[model samples]
Target: MTTQSIKVTIKRGPDGQGAFDVPAHDNQTVLDVVSWVQQNADPTLSYRFACRVGMCGSCAMMVNGVPRWTCRTHISKVIKDGAVTIAPLRNLPVIKDLVVDMDPFFDKWVEAEGVHHGSLTRHDPIAPVDETSATRVEANAGIECINCSVCYAACDTVAGNPDYLGPAALQRAWTLLNDAKDEGRGAILDAVSGSGGCHNCHSIGSCTTYCPNDLDPMSAIAGLKRETTKSFFRRGR
Candidate 1:
């Protein structure tokens, strides 16, 4: 219900000190302001978004130095002094303007073996698993991840060491590790073990602090440390 014009400033490129000044409404989200500028003020301004309603992970950016979903971020809360600074999400290669290269962010998922791998035979009798089972409940917590990379972008671990697989991807691996159907749980754990893997997570939890979806990636990383340690005893049969 605010009726004032919002002062919005956007950092146009990687290491860009210059900013694009734009006029925005108090009620408008940061995403709305950026779109308006692209449509009316600067046609060449580059950014990325899809499903502006907040379901798609494409619209994440740095709103006043915090990685967040621009579509859902309100100007009022972000701009305490009536001024806003928009920039590309942190810990990634800035391609141009507000757009960033997402390849490295996604590559970590593969590194952690985030994909599900099960060897269930459809011809065999179906196993009746309780809907309220503990494993299922634990997996449910991580199932809502939208892969926005905000957690990865906010993580100091990822920022310091580029090879680190990151919290989001590691969290995905943790979900699979507890799955009864996942035959690759052992391999997934193997992939995520060691220094550059789960052990390197300092548990500073910047990922959980900045995750827009309210996920606790820090706990997931802890799970990896526990499970991988247990597996060490069983190694080599």
Candidate 2:
């Protein structure tokens, strides 16, 4: 019996770059291919993955020019001409083969004021949250983000503007803004309304298109825009 094979090309930075013909199997995922390469072909191949079930976005990579979670991306879905190309996520500094520096990606989150600032301390009585409220509904829309950076990698605005806060950061800001208990509304708005803020977004929807969790960071940015505009008008009055 003869085993079928697929061509796999990996972008291995300056020193190493090449393709390998690996045995293909049914229901094989891109992660599986990469793991095989590291285990059989090259032990030096470096990549990051925590949860292979798609919960952790650490396995995200550029597959065929699109950012996708390698663990969830099956070879059958993305294979073209019996071949696949894997590279580090774009708009980030490549650390090595299939790995990119995530510091800058996370730094933007802090710059966007994505962290929650509460008015109450831990000793204070916990306030009951109205889950059905309008603000809660909007907040819930983007709260599922795992900071996978998939949307960040797909965003063209981030590619062009290095200072621009990427989709995840801006979306997180919007999420915090809608939280009833959050007291950082003023700071978040001020942060996102700056030159490299939400306005820098091209509204291309690539963040939404590539988000593995199906969260819409594009819409969240639009929400920030609307809120910022309203904030601008209210201050004038």
Candidate 3:
């Protein structure tokens, strides 16, 4: 009996594709296929992975032209005609084969003021907050993001407007805005109110669609739109 194999085509960073014949197994993931090629075919094959169980979100890549967590993507689900194409995430600089530069993705976070700006000091007593409050509920909606950049790669807005704060950053800003202890809500609103902010989103919902964590970045951006608009008019008042 002939051993079953899967055709793997990996797009190297600016160098073009590297084709390989990888042996297939039951319940094999895309990452497993890549790992086989790297271990058996080409030792130079490059990629990223951590906590392969899906919590880290570092194993994201373009599998068959769709951004996905390779560890979570089973070959059975994605492979077509015994072939799979793998490439680096889009809208970001490719560092090597399947490894894209994440600096631009995270930089948008800084630009969006995604970090928490809390007024509470270590010396200050612990403040009680209602976990079931609407604000907390809203904050929790977008807080599970692991910075995978999958949504960033899938985002059409980021592709059109390079300066547009991508879904993750805007989602982060939304979460921070709803945080009751945050002191930088005003600054965050100002940051996201710019031309490159939440308004740039077309509500295409690609971010919500491709998120490995199943997050709702589109809704978060919508929240930012409403909040920023309110802030704009409040300032006018």
Candidate 4:
């Protein structure tokens, strides 16, 4: 065991004075140490967690200046010399301690027009799709996202522009576009092509790297851009 105590600084409140420190433990993750502080060190500690397995995007937070899912982040790997800092994810208003309101994060989904507008009702016959089709394969991995905004927090574009749809929404739009049967493709493209749309992304690939699911939203955004460009030329943009 490393004989070093990882220093963990956490945002305690809304006040500018909101700050607290905790020592690290050997083989401990940021989440584990935070849980330790909340359980034994500080009773007033507040944070969010579900499925401690990293499958749920609920436990994302700023660790050592980067947004990460605490459950999967090991303190030994992140904290330097037994030093660490924790806080709610950035680009979102803090509720308290370590929890940030997710309404805005999810609100972007609707804002992106992520919902499919296909006329095919649930009662309609299920259209046959080639499982091995390129588009289906493209849609496969992206559909696995659990709605965690780690990518959102890690995105500098979202930080720069609040109205930007962020990675997840564009990824969802890409998924719908790949559906081939969805009727909302044009609207999705148009919505994302405008201000705060898919065009806003600077393509830094932060969303690709931080994604827990290994999905590349940059690629999805690229796909949207290509589709938008094709339509743009067809319509004289």
Candidate 5:
């Protein structure tokens, strides 16, 4: 049997870059390539992955200059010229090879008030919500985000404006805003209405284009814009 090989180049921060020739197999994923390089070629290689099945976005990286979940990206789909390049996600500080500091991305999540502030406590009764309601539908649209930072890495707004809250955080805000049991609507609006808020988005649609889960953050940002406008008028400011 003949062995098939592929060239894999990885950007190693502070240690320069490394390239390896690895055996390739059919139905292989980008994460598989990375893992092969780490195990067989270079044990020093550092990366992140969990639930290689793709539910967890921890394996997200830059594959051919695009942010993607390595676990979900098939090598056959992204291989170019019999080679592939892997790098840490962009729009965030690189912690090491193929690893980025996620603090900024998550800090903006807090800034966007992504957490659910419940209107009721354990002592209170469960709130009945109509599943078919417009608010519920809108909220459910963006509630599946796993905070993998793929969308944030793909966002041009965050690349230009360091203070800009990226798509994931803003999308979470949009989800929480429509939650009938949430009591932080006003706070969420205030967070996304500032200088580094959703208005700063250029509507490049990169977030939606790169989302691994197919979530439409562009629409969420647009909803924030409309709601903020209404909020402004309500404040009479």
Candidate 6:
């Protein structure tokens, strides 16, 4: 029996597509294929991976036109016609072959006030929190996000508007908004209600659809919209 081979197409910076042939293996991951190409075929190829397990979320990329965790994505699951297309995450500047600039993705966190702001100081004791509280429930929903940027790359709003605070950032802000210990909800709400904030999201739900961690960023964004609108009305009262 003849061993089968697979063709992989990678998107290179400004230049174009780069194709490579690799031997096929059972239960091979997309990351495994990319690593093989880099080690055997092209040594100049550049990409990023840390944990190789899905926990780190650093190895996410576009596989066959959808942003996914390459380390966890099996070739058998995504192979099309004995081929696969690997590309950098979308909605960010490409730095080199299969590498993208993450500065902008993180900057949106500042825009959305995603940072935690608590009134308690180190001198102060940790406040007792009720795990079953509604606010805690809301915060827990989005707390598992690993700053993967996959949801941001998959978001259509981020693709169209450069200033739009992407899904990860806004989802983070929503969680902080509900955090009982956070003292910045008012200011965060103000930021999220601004021009490129939660109101700009069209609720297309692409962010929710593509999140590898199964988070519903669309729901979080909607909560921000409702709360912000209510805050706006209360100020006028």
Give per-model TM-scores: 0.92, 0.97, 0.97, 0.92, 0.97, 0.98
Across residues 38-143, which tens digit of lDDT does each residue of candidate 2 receive? 9999998999999899997999999989999999999999998888899989999988888899999999999999898987988999988999999999999999
1-237: candidate 4 lDDT, tens digit per residue: 464454667865474423345554666777898888888777878899988888887999898779899999887678676567787888888888788988998888887778867777889998888879999888775899888888998899999999999999989988988886777877888888889898889999999998988899999999988998899999994
Regions of model 3 farther than 4 Å from truth: 1-3
Worst 10 residues of 3 by lDDT: 1-10
Estimate, for each residue in 49-124, the C-alpha lDDT of model 3 and write its tens digit. 9898999999999999999999999999988888889999999999988899999999999999999897788999
Off by over 4 Å in 4: 16-26
TM-score of candidate 4 versus the correct structure, residues matched by position:
0.92
Instruction: Report model 6's TM-score to 2 decimal places.
Output: 0.98
| Residue pairs in clash, model 2 | none
Q: On residues 195-230, what C-alpha lDDT tens digit does candidate 5 reach at each position?
A: 999899889999999898999999999999999999
lDDT of 4: 0.83
Clashes of 1: 0
Off by over 4 Å in 1: 1-4, 15-18, 121-127
Cα displacement (Å) at residue 202, model 5: 0.9
Off by over 4 Å in 5: 1-3
* Better candidate by TM-score, 4 or 6: 6
Q: What would the per-residue lDDT of candidate 6 be over residues 86-113, giving only the tens digit for each residue?
A: 9999999999988999999999999889
lDDT score, residue 23, model 2?
94
lDDT against the true structure, per candidate, is: 0.84, 0.93, 0.93, 0.83, 0.92, 0.93
**Per-residue accuracy of model 1 over 1-237 as CA lDDT, tens digit each:** 253555667887755644455565656788988898889777888999999988997999998889999999887778766678888888888899899998997888888999989666889787665658888777778888999999988998888998899999999998887676677987898899956799899999898898888989999999899889888878857
